[model samples]
Target: MKISNETKIGVLTAFAITIMILGFNFLKGKTLFGTSHTMYAKYTNVQGLATSNPVMINGLQVGTVYSITTDKNMKEILVNMTLTKDVNIPVNSYATIKNNPLGTTTVEIRLGDAMQYLPKDDTIRTETSAGILDAAVQEIRPVLGQVKNAVKSLDSVLMTVNSVVDPNAKNNIRGILENLNKTTAGLTESSASLNTLLNTQTGALAKSLNNVSSFTGNLANNNDKLTAVMTNLDKTTTNLSNLDLQKTLTTLDATVTELKASLGKLNTTNGTAGMLLNDPKLYNNLAATANKINVLLDDIKTNPKRYISFSVFGKKNKSEPLKYPLPDTLNAPYIILQK
Candidate 1:
């Protein structure tokens, strides 16, 4: 068959249009020969979800996001996913947009285990998750706020320090450094002298240390005696502990209580001791009796015949004072007064 140029151009134009359509559908992840179903989901935010983005189920690519549209109120976004017919979406399946760490977004349809499958063009559940950067920003917000506050505090402290610093601070610091250098030099000299002194005394110091070590060795050798002494101390302490100290304390307390009670009784006016202590009349009577005895003694001394009589050869003798027979117990010349 002989074809004309007009027919050839017409065929070429049609072929080109078909190839463009196929290429467009291929780019949109659509299989021209495969059967697919449309599923709908409503989302509040798409989070950079776009058409031609791969829809995955169990990490397998089964569909692509077909279109995104807003509802009448523009409050919710309607997302249409064109999934292959072989991919069965359950009634309660959910479509979620996931973000990768590489800063790319993907749609994932999580298949549920419901026996009922969703009809074509039916709206499934939708959920939105924050992107990696979004989540990172969210987590870092408080830390950044704290860092900002710390920065402000540091700035204020630095301002205060700057204000408090003298204009001659540099000169003062230099002077201080110079003084420090001098001090360091003096310390170096002192250290050298001390090192020399230490060198001179090293032998004596070593000898003293050796003596101390020998003393310690001797002590260590007598450890058995020390142990025995400690054992004796323990036994003494045990014996002291075993004594009835509590009973002794109780007895002492009782004695003290009785003594206090006796003292209290002695202070009362009814007791003999109290009468001796507190009675003025008894004291006066005792004084008067002593005075009368003194007068009697004086009278007896002046008139010997009034108190004494002597008989010599059956006749009365008044020249000498009479003497009564004394008991054997009364050997002394002094009179013994009994109460």
Candidate 2:
């Protein structure tokens, strides 16, 4: 074998190419030199994501970013990653960036939620999230502005609050509080007399209530006796109503029967009440006797001298009228007729 110079140059060029390919694959934690399945990812910004950055699936580096370029037409950076064919990433997995603290570049590619088996050499959906430092810087911008505004306004608020807490003003407030306390003390003193008067009235009210209780107890005791009397009266009235002895109807029926029997006995002609009750001939005789008595009384009323005769032999009429006139005064006459 003749070691020629041209052959040596050709061999070194091939060796350098082999070394570059191995280095690219070694950076992705894959075999040094093998056929890497090509896959692509798109990111919003790939400022520091280099071609040699390792692509890790679940914290295991399995690939490297093989190429990175911003497409002028799409206005998004294209990140083409060379992944080991043995490494499977789920289609729904996410890609996030990792960078150093200086925030100058990102070189770490991490896969998240990579459980599903993706296609060989498939272009997975890309996402670009800022590193913690960059997010912190972005977040701090608004917060720092608020701090600057607060610092600018603090002096005026301090000045306003200082006036309220001043020692002289506190002393004046203390004096006003002490005067109000003295006025409250005077009112408390005045209320002591009112409290005493209320105590006296309370004592009198207790005595009056005691007297009323005694009177009410007496009334209650007497009410029991009164109730007993009323009960007895009601019992007496009920017994009298139910006995039937006091009813005049019973006696009246018996008296009516007995009187009917007596009337039956007396109804004969010789009976005393039967004459008035049934005798028409006796009524006629009584009527005739009444007629004689009426005639006699009428004759007495007409001429009283018919029942008597005047005897005046000692006194002679010395003078007489031409016509003999009846005496104005009827003289007592001797009885000549006897009934």
Candidate 3:
């Protein structure tokens, strides 16, 4: 058998392409020959993830990322996932990329509830994301700044305390003790004066304490009386309950209704109170009376002696003044005379 060089190159290329395709399918967590259904998820960033990436659950191969494409609107990277036909996903299922704390990263889909079945070829929404480590690294700056300021404040406080508590600047102990003794003597005298005050008010304090004790004793002694009153109240309530409560309530309702009707009648134009309330003639009479009173007050203001007369018989006037006849409208209770 004689093979040409051109045929050998073509065979090698075809074998290489087969191996590459199989390797890609294996990396995507799929059997190279198995059938899969498609789903889609969008990520803010692809995070070095690419086509043919394996989608796994609990380290088991389930599916593969079929393709990764940037949105034409330039918002997100959309990932098309081709999962095994048997992998049932709930509608609430989500896909997330997980990196090993120390190793290569991969994508995983979390099946929401095993109880509920997911139909094939369902698109899962990526509503939440586990943020990148870069975001947390950005926060270290402000925290470090605060730590620096706290250290500076501590240093300033130490400096102030050092000046205040200098060994050479500390005052003499005996002088301080002497002043303290004088203060204690004054306090003792004040305490003695306060004790004397208590002695002076002792009888009143004792009487007040006795009154409090008597009140407490009365409360203690009347507990049975209070209990008996409560018992009587309960008996009265039971007796009232034994009466025709429904009929009594009905009567009360009727009486209240009648009272309301009577009150309404009082306010209506037909009744006497109603006439007084609604009548224009009554208001006109009131206005006339007010005007007359205003005029009388004005007259008294002009000539005080005519309306208000003061006479001192013993010391000044030496004669009784004539008493004016009291008017029915001006029947006030009392009139006080001033010296």
Candidate 4:
């Protein structure tokens, strides 16, 4: 039988609607023709969990979140999950809403070892997991606080520096840098001069080094002479060391003492020499006797006949005895004239 165009259009539209609804439900993890179980969980916070989010069991999606609602007092969030898979969930199993940092939120079911299974529409234990962002924030919170404190300390230090560094201080610092540069320049000049002074061909240091080398060569050539000299010096030192210096010094000390005693006697009137040295009257008398003897010798030399009469003809010539000494006729005289 041929249908009307309107009726055919209506049938197509109905089929399209049915297909769309099935797709929508399938995308929501709902099984319209297959068996599915619903479970409920209560939480103080859902952590941005929404409907149609996957429910995972060991990384496998077994269900989806059906709906989310608040309790009568609105003190807690109640979430219903529809399980699409036939896997048994223990009565002691717990469900957690996992909030991801870079992805969608979900419900994860952790199974317990209980033999008994949870029935449909039953309440499951609920827990909330810390999101990656939340955990990172928790880890970084203390570090952020420390960074803030460090920034404050740095700001305070900068303020202190700003207060301490003035225009005059800046000038002084510049002057110090200038002086340091001058010192560096002087050091460079000194280094250049030192290099010049150490030149191998022409420098004073080189000349001195050559001289020293020559001296060392001469010493090397005279090694035997040096050794002989050193031996002689050693023998001399040995002889000196072997000498009885103490006995010599004792004898010298005794001689010096005797000489000192003799000198002391001479300084006093204890001996003839001392009387001659110390008594003026005896000294004057000796002087007079020496003068008279000198005059008699002079008179005898001048008048020989008065002292010795010797004649073959018995000549007796009379000459007045020299009461006073005649003037020395000869320039040569042995006695010192006393006036």
Clashes per candidate, residues 3 or more apart or on different chains: 0, 3, 0, 0
Candidate 4 lDDT score relative to the true structure: 0.89
Tell me how candidate 2 scores on lDDT: 0.69
Alpha-carbon RMSD of each model:
18.5, 22.2, 31.2, 15.6
Summing lDDT over every window of 10 consecutive residues in candidate 4, give the lowest-scoring window: 326-335
Model 3 accuracy (lDDT, Cα): 0.73
Instruction: For candidate 4, list the clashing residue pairs, or say none.
Output: none
| Backbone clash tally (model 3) | 0
What would the per-residue lDDT of candidate 2 be over residues 72-159, giving only the tens digit for each residue? 6757777777776566566776666776656434334444565676676676776667767779999999999999999879977888
The parts of candidate 4 lying over 4 Å away from their true place are: 1-188, 267-285, 294-316, 327-339
**Model 2 CA lDDT for position 71:** 58
Off by over 4 Å in 1: 71-74, 133-339
Query: lDDT for every model?
Result: 0.80, 0.69, 0.73, 0.89
TM-score of 1: 0.39
Residue-level lDDT of model 4, residues 1-339, one tens digit each, is 989999999999999999999998777778979999898999988888898999999999999998889958878998988998989899889998888858989899999999999888899997677778788999999999999999999999999988999999989999999999999999999999999999999889999999999999999999999999999999999999999999999999999999999999999999899998899999778767766776788788778887687776767658676666556623333655699
lDDT of 3 at 275: 88
Flag clash pairs in model 3: none
